[model samples]
Target: MKLLIIAPEQIPVPPRAGGSVENVIHQITSRLPEGHRVTIVSLRRGYLPRKSVSGPVTNLRVPGGSKKRYLANALRRVKGLAFDLIQIDNRPGFAAAVRNAFPHTPIAVFMHSMTFASPPMTTRRKANADFRHADLIVGNSLSLQRSLMSRFPAHRSKIAYVHLGVDTAQFRPSGKRRRGGYRFLFAGRMIPRKGVPTLLRAFKIARKSVPSIRLSVAGGTGKAAYRAFLRRTARRLNVPVRFKGNLPRKRMPAFYRSGDCFVCPSQEHEAFGLVNVEAMASGLPVIASRNGGIPEIVKDGRNGFLVTRYGKPAAFAARMAELARSPELHRRLSEQARSDAERYFGWQLTAAKLMELYAERLKTASAGRRTK
Candidate 1:
């Protein structure tokens, strides 16, 4: 089957910068069943050709502009291309427009987040209309699926959830064990939602018990003020912290291996924390807040502990200290974490599930047409 995927305008297909949605799209397209043709439409830098082939996927680049304009221009450009199915990644407006432009094709709107949670009334209305018309809607996690259902109960029949997958080959465990002092790692955008300040306080408290405990914070800095606040808090509390600037996706495995434990203290409801899977794949015990889809992946006390009492530095600190002190516990969790990742979260599994869904949709569409 020929597939055309419309990605968000911010990121390209084979994501150079870190984009979870783009990365997933790339993985699904690259791993699709043999003989299936795939084309991706996304934004491009200045003056590049409008269309080109990148590796096995055909990329159509729309000039950077307003979301509405990008969608309009892209629809006009792809009017001539034929496809059996159209997959839209995360843009409600784009999904609505594409449904109108190609009414007969099977369209699936893949939801990556709770995008309509806090938007204005007008935007919410538009999103509702878009979602209502889509033939299928898939969320990355059950948490996100529930949120969507709560907002649009009428669409629940069409909504389903699929867990995002990680590249196990790139994130497999190193045979080396944790040496020297205990190390903790936090990777993601340094934003308020990420709970960096809370992480700092927790790390400082953990250091009181384990003086040799150190933290390595890595990811893009979202806000300069928040970055400054984190630094000041670390210094004021005398926590030994190292700020590793945003590392590329290729270098993430080394970053995960360099630490003994992984912590994600996100205060916001994450759709799915891809980093959690990557760290698990790297064989590091993870400690994350029990919010959103995090619980679906972390499996509290099995692979790692999930801190339910969020925003409490003491609770987070206790978990960190426990992992640092118990090498036996750490070893057990590490082995289980790697096992879980390999068994459940590989890109191949994700692609195979998607292929099955696509084939089912195509078959159903064919049957409906024959009945008519």
Candidate 2:
């Protein structure tokens, strides 16, 4: 079957960025059946074209067309193209534009994140309406699925849940090694919603008790003032937290390997905990919040301990301190974390499941056409 994939912008086919959406796209394309023609319509030039990461397929770069020129580009290709299905990776008006381009083709949308709900109420309604147009909708996590269903109940039957998978092969269990100090790692954007402040406070409390502890934060400071506030808070609280600002993706595995444990203290708005998954894959126990899709990934006390949503510096600190002291608990959780990641979050499993969903959607679309 010929497939047309519409994306907001060019994403590397096994994406070097290590983002969940990019991983999903890479996995799906790689696992598609043989003899299937897959033409990727990416908006920008960051990704290379004609590179085969997966199967025998052709990836076409769209060269970043404007809304004004969308119809022109689509019209030019629509005449000669024999696309059996159209699949979109994001919203942001890209899917709507593709729908306009190929009105009759069956289009399935992959909702990587809840972009509509994240925005203000005024714009959210409009975004929700646009999403309702897709024939099939895929959510990366159950939390995301619930959020989407709450807004648009009519399409609940059409929605499917396909959790994001990690590269377990790259991130696997290597027996616990003693690192320099009781190292604590946090990797993600240094933003408010990520609950960096909560992690900071907990680290501060932990450091007061465990004097030899060290905290390393990696990721771009998304909000400048928030970044400053965190630094100031660390100074005032007397916490030894080192901000390793924005390390490259290639360096992440080494960073995770070096750290003793990983913490993702997001207050809320975390649809799925990709950072935690990476840490788990790297054979480290996670100290994550019990909110959003975090609980889905982490089995509290089994794989890792899940702290309450709100900040309790003493409690959070105590947990960290305990982990520091009890190498056995750390080792157990680390083993379990890696085991869970391998059992549930493999790219091969992700690719196979996605193909199943696509096949089911195609079958449904074919049946509907026959009935008409």
Candidate 3:
């Protein structure tokens, strides 16, 4: 089968910078079945060739001035190419444009978030049209699927859920935990929706019980004001915190290995917490909020604990303290976390499931054409 993937304009495929969508595209394409051919279309800055082949995937770079213009140019460039399926990654506008341009081709729009599920009139109309045109709408988690269904009940039959997977081989356990202190790590944007403030307050409270406990945060400093606010909150609480800004993707394994436990205190309805899986694959116990698809990934008392209430610092703190105080429990969760990641979440399984979906959709389309 021939596959064409439309990636976000902000980042490149096999992302040098941080982009979950691009990373996922890379993961799926790299692990595709042996007989398949894949091509990726993305926006690149400055003057670069319009088309080129990178490794096994053909990359077509469009100008990055405007998303609408880029999509228009991308469609023009791939006008004559033949592809069995067109898979778009989390861009409703692009999906709509591609569906219009290639009416005969089967298009799959993969939704990573509920950004378009709820809206203020105009957005809903566009999102509805995008979903209505696509042959299938793939959600990365069941939480996202349910949200999409609630917002657009008419399209529930077209919606499907597929869990995101991580690279277990690269994020595997290092067989070493920090001595003398329990280190808790958080890796993501430093923003309110991520529940950074809640994590900070929880850390402060946990420190009261376990003084040796430490917290490290690593991610792109989203807003300058948010970074300042986080720093001030950390000092005001007198909790020992380390802020490592924008760690590279290559260094993430070491970052995960350096910690005793992983914490994802997300207040927003996260579609799927990829970091939680990465940390679990690193053989670290995870403590995350029971929001969105997090519950699907982090099973409470199995891999780690989940705070049921959102923004409850006290509950989060209690979980932190429990893991810090009990070494046997921590070890048990750590082992289970890695085992779970290996058993269920891997790129190979993700690719296989996707291929099965693609094949099914193509077969049904062919049958419809025969009947027509």
lDDT of 2 at 327: 83
lDDT (C-alpha, whole model) for all candidates: 0.86, 0.74, 0.87
**Best-to-worst ranking by lDDT:** 3, 1, 2
Q: Candidate 3, residues 1-372: lDDT per residue as tens digits?
A: 899998877777767757888889988888877788888988875445667675667878777667888788778878988899999888866776898788899999888888644464238767887778788889999999898888878888888888889899899999754676899999997767899899999998898999899999998865898898889999998888999998878999999998999999999899998999999999999999999999999999999999998589999999999999999999999999999999988988888898888889999999999999
lDDT of 2: 0.74
Look at candidate 1 and tell me the lDDT of residue 366: 95
- What digit string (tens of lDDT, one per residue) describes model 2 on residues 1-372? 677776545344445654446556756676665566677654334556533334555655444456446434544554567677877775535556667767888788887777643465227566667666688888888988898788778778887878877777666555556657989999997777788888888887787778898899988765788878988988988878888877867777878887888988887667787878889998888988888788899888988888874556566677889898888998899889898988998777776777678878889889989999
Taking all chains together, each candidate's TM-score versus the true structure is: 0.94, 0.89, 0.96
| Deviation (Å) of 75 in candidate 1 | 1.8
Q: What is the C-alpha lDDT profile of model 1 across 133-211, one tens digit per residue?
A: 6888888888998988888887888788888888888898888866879999999988788898899999988888988
On the 0 to 100 scale, the lDDT of residue 330 in model 1 is: 95
Candidate 3: where are CA atoms >4 Å away?
A: 45-55, 120-122
Q: Pick the candidate with the highest TM-score.
A: 3
lDDT of 1: 0.86
Candidate 3 RMSD to the real structure: 1.7
